[model samples]
Target: MNARIPTDLSSSLKAEEDSNHSDNPSFDTVLAARLSRRGLLRGGAGTVGTVVLGGMGLTACGGGDDPAPTTPPAPGTPTETLLGFGAVAKSLADMVVVPAGYTASVLYALGDPLNAGTAAYKNDGTDTGFENRAGDHHDGMEWFGLDAAGKASATATARGLLAMNHEATTDELRSSFFLHANGGTTTLPRPAAEVDKETAIHGVSIVEVQQAAGKWTTVQNSAFNHRLTCLSDNIQLNGPARGNALMVTKYSTTGVQTRGTLNNCGTGKTPWGSFVTGEENWAGYFTRASTDDTARGGATAKSVVSLKRYGRNAGSRSRHGWETGGADDKYARWNVGQSGASLDGSDDYRNELNTFGYIVEMDAYDKTQMPRKRTALGRFAHESAAFGKPVVGQPLAVYMGDDSRGEYIYKFVSTKTWVAADANPANRITTGDSYLDAGKLYVAKFASDGSGSWVELAMSNPLISGYATYAFADQADVLVNARLAADAVGATKMDRPEWCSTNVNNGEIYFTLTNNSNRAIDSASMPPDSANPRVYEDTKGASTSKGNVNGHILRVKEGAAGNAALVFTWDVYVFGAESGAAAGSVNLSSLTSDQDFSSPDGLAFSPSTGILWIQTDDGAYTDVTNCMMLAALPGTVGDGAKKTLSYTKADTTTLSVDTYVGQAPTADKLKRFLVGPKSCEITGMCETPDGKAMFINIQHPGETTAMADIADPTKYASQWPSNAGYGAGKRPRSATIVITKTDGGRIGS
Candidate 1:
């Protein structure tokens, strides 16, 4: 038996962006003057007009006097680029220009069909079986292999299981507009067929893939390949939220189970052979009943408070509008309203929104067991939870980041430690249940001195209970609305926390801060500390549009105490910016042509190879280059030179400069390995256990391009996998690409 699929259904939606955050922080022309020094480098083919700001000046970019390695290997070969940058070149709109001797290719993409019976995908937005095939918006992924002869273990480049999260589907392609679908009300409610198909397309899909010779192929016959969708009929809930009064609805009077999982995003591959897929952005799926809110069950004001914190309650509009379609509860449940005379919770089953945003677990090698939602993890827009292989009796720990504008990062330490994988089959799932069912959920509070603390959100903790902003109910409620709880505890609001990955070797953690425009120099926003130091205007495109710069990666380590209770030290390992931007003595690493990026999104630490794969989906710099992925060898959290950043506030209080002591993502260190199609985001990558093959997901190839414009293939924005000749024409699909060396050599050196 392989992984189980989660059936717990409820209501959840995307975390709402805090409107109270700093909207636009004003920056001076001086910062812009510094960026002007960045040299504009030309991009490769098809990027005639693309030019990037390279070779940042002021000694900070290339700040070190280190020379290029005397014995450099051939170009396009795996010569692991360390986290601290060296002499790598950064260019605009170009082919992946790596350090030397590294090779890269598309392993999979959007429209490729997995099974033998499925027809080939047409790159056009129009394609049949796409629902049963691969969905769009691929995010986190993992690689698991079958034990075989000559299997290279970590080095095995042959075959394995590929599991992925679909994240969010864009309306730019599928013609489903949230506010207005067709032209009028007649076209309203969207076709039930479309809603069903789209809902069916939203969950997680696990498939077995094989690498023969140098090419990787899908093993369609493998029973392990299964799909989990929101439309699935038999899924149930099994956490603190399950059977809770909040989860009660018309569908399940017992409140023990629900329907399906949605917004399945960042994922974690387990030491016990299962995968944890988090449901994010689930709040957008429901419509709150406005009228009888106070009357139904005569619920208290606090009951409604929970709904609002999680993006539910009365006056909420259904983006999908599936509720307007029919009188049957199947379609009407999406409406989320309480009405009628029936004494049961079924009358106007609106509380369905309470059932989403959970971390679901599934075994990769087995398919007979349904996926299970491990509720103890505490829900939000969970990005990913990374854990190392468990040793017998060790605390089964996993790290996570909530993907929202002002969310916090977390770590789950199991009450029951680890046991051998198959030593006790009878208590296997039970062991997992006990460990994850209840535990401490801590929010990160980064301080200026480079040390941070995991503030406990347990209601009994003074930080949570004593806060005046909101009340922390219990562990279940704390997990249900973790964001609000984290905010009340004064958790450090980061630059949009995205993904968290712990190194396979040293257990160090790295997380991506995907840009935050809400940051400012004001007291409430960014108060200019050494951690979140600079507050500058990052203008978008050719104009001075005010917003946050791309974003940076944060690395942290535990203090004296190795447990979650101890304070941790941290540093900004790398900041996303164009080399042409201004800089002083502070910005530690000297960014060059080979290693400059904006908005680092997907973060991965390949345990087999000890390589950090940093992928980018940048709006701040996409005008110059396509979204890209790079490889880096990261040092421990505090392993870099320390520099201070100074900021002067209007209130006459001078903010001392940020003190950064970290390795730079230099040219020779962080080099681009691959770039995505023109209008798409390059996300989700995993290779064979042996390192011979790589699987990269290209999501929404023509995401930003208009549908009307994409109708003509010749004028299409992205020629992706088709351009690489995986199939026929240049229709772009968000499928996973299988990348391997032509000579079948080991990946990144």
Candidate 2:
């Protein structure tokens, strides 16, 4: 979710476009019948007891699961409480706020010098060399523990490498105003210097941080401090589509390599000790000429179909206008039109757009190693990749979500079974090659009866083999244009699926369905469904927003076979809403002011405590307070009964939908923990092995400031770390904060 662009211009941005025009059935009608037959919707509301299955699976690589409890409690021992902190109140202040006994301290921020050789950041628009400094808009992050000797250590608590994604920069009118003097140029032919700075800040950053004397500080000039900018080269393309013709580019004639990873939104830690991130909203960074379709053989051509299907229709403009930076190769690569003399696409960047939208893997500890794009995962607007519980002899599974209005959820199962010893192998990237390089990709098809199945997205599948819209060439084509394949297989369309996390205790998976603006009850294009059953109006000041104004969290329990199970059951873990909304409808979660939240985005389960940390990147609820994070001790699926909801259309017609509701959470089970500064989104969370310290990212404070007001400190929407007495200037910046208990106990305890 790039908040840099205002909502009024969303329709013009290809990345934010709703491209799904499939005729798949909504879940409303079938779900009502299923709930009625089961007698679960009898009393309007009910609570059902669910049986817990034993033999919880192992954590996937980078699924962020803490170590399991050492051993079961002795006979007669008392059970431990799930949560032990008071809820923090909602806030609209311009600073970070936490619960009473916790201390939130700033550890790293945008423009901060990563190495001693780089001069200090003045916080003004005159800073340069962003490739050697902290990138902007920090999002998903993962902690790679290190030993006292500066070696990789899974249990290290005092020192580690913080690898995170700098998704995008704050921009206005196609210019990154916050990064230039006089707000730079907004017209075409963008300056090369401004474009260079903007490009360097939209990738990934890995920096070392250490704790000494009860304080956390970034280790400047450390060997692990490195930046992979948009200009970085030598990124390997591994998987089924590595050397395919669709990937050929002037820089990589063999189609085995590509340039830097762009718009990385989420982070993962591989089971083999590597950092994995997803390229999200990368389609908007490339410009396609108006004559591209004609030059590539018209609208009926396979290349033209792919370009349009991925939101890169002919005549689309780049987000930052980077293509007009001159004729140099660095700037020319941004233009993804057909301008080459060869038909193979080896002489130009016409195929460069095919190289991104992947789950990129890199070793956080090895600065010399290049990141590898795992193409077998199936490319799209990937939000994040969360692995399932690893079973030693069973195939490993990685769950993913395509973050768009009507996209689908996906999973990739490795061909090779997992081996426990490989978790700590000598070479992490090589180990990734064994599992990530070859896999069977599947898209979820959720049914109306609260059941779902994983449909394979391979050439062998009849739906893809006989797809009428787009003829498939080979396996590589299916992987490169996976959205088309998913549609051909009749996969369920989700309401902007964002992040996926695996519960460590039972191996159940949870996905965050961030709100969808295009959803409607009466419209045929996108009607309300059982899985995504909501359409309401929320007013913020003088404006009103329709559709699913607030999102919800959906959790799934695998079948008897666990992660490898093709069949599964699902339920709405909670529907985000205002505390005062009508119950059994919008406020289905029954959340009080202390536990209410909207547009749940970032989700992670504490590996040590089993508490689920939920973060928000919201716009609907900003009128009440800034975005916040909450901690919850969630129950398993099927813990609650089913209920039917009816919506009144503008024409007075009744539209009903039956849905499975999870057990209602009390303040004790769920509570707000932190709220970020004004106009900021609280995202990306991780903790130390012991769970004593938690790291959270606050992104894009003061993002709404007008470009003309760049020099006026008072006109800024916010002055965050600076107002909090950090750094040198009044400019707002995205930064990472470390939270710890005052009494030296584990967080959330």
Q: lDDT of all the models against the reference?
A: 0.60, 0.83
Model 2: residues with Cα > 4 Å off, grouped in runs: 3-8, 29-81, 648-653
My TM-score estimates for the predictions, one after another, are: 0.83, 0.93
What lDDT is reached at residue 635 by model 2?
94
For candidate 2, write residues 429-477 as lDDT tens digits: 8899999999799999887778999999989998899999899999999
Best by TM-score: 2
lDDT of 1 by residue, 148-190 (tens): 5522133344657788877656553223321122311334556
Q: What is the overall TM-score of model 1 with all chains considered together? A: 0.83
Clashes of 2: 5
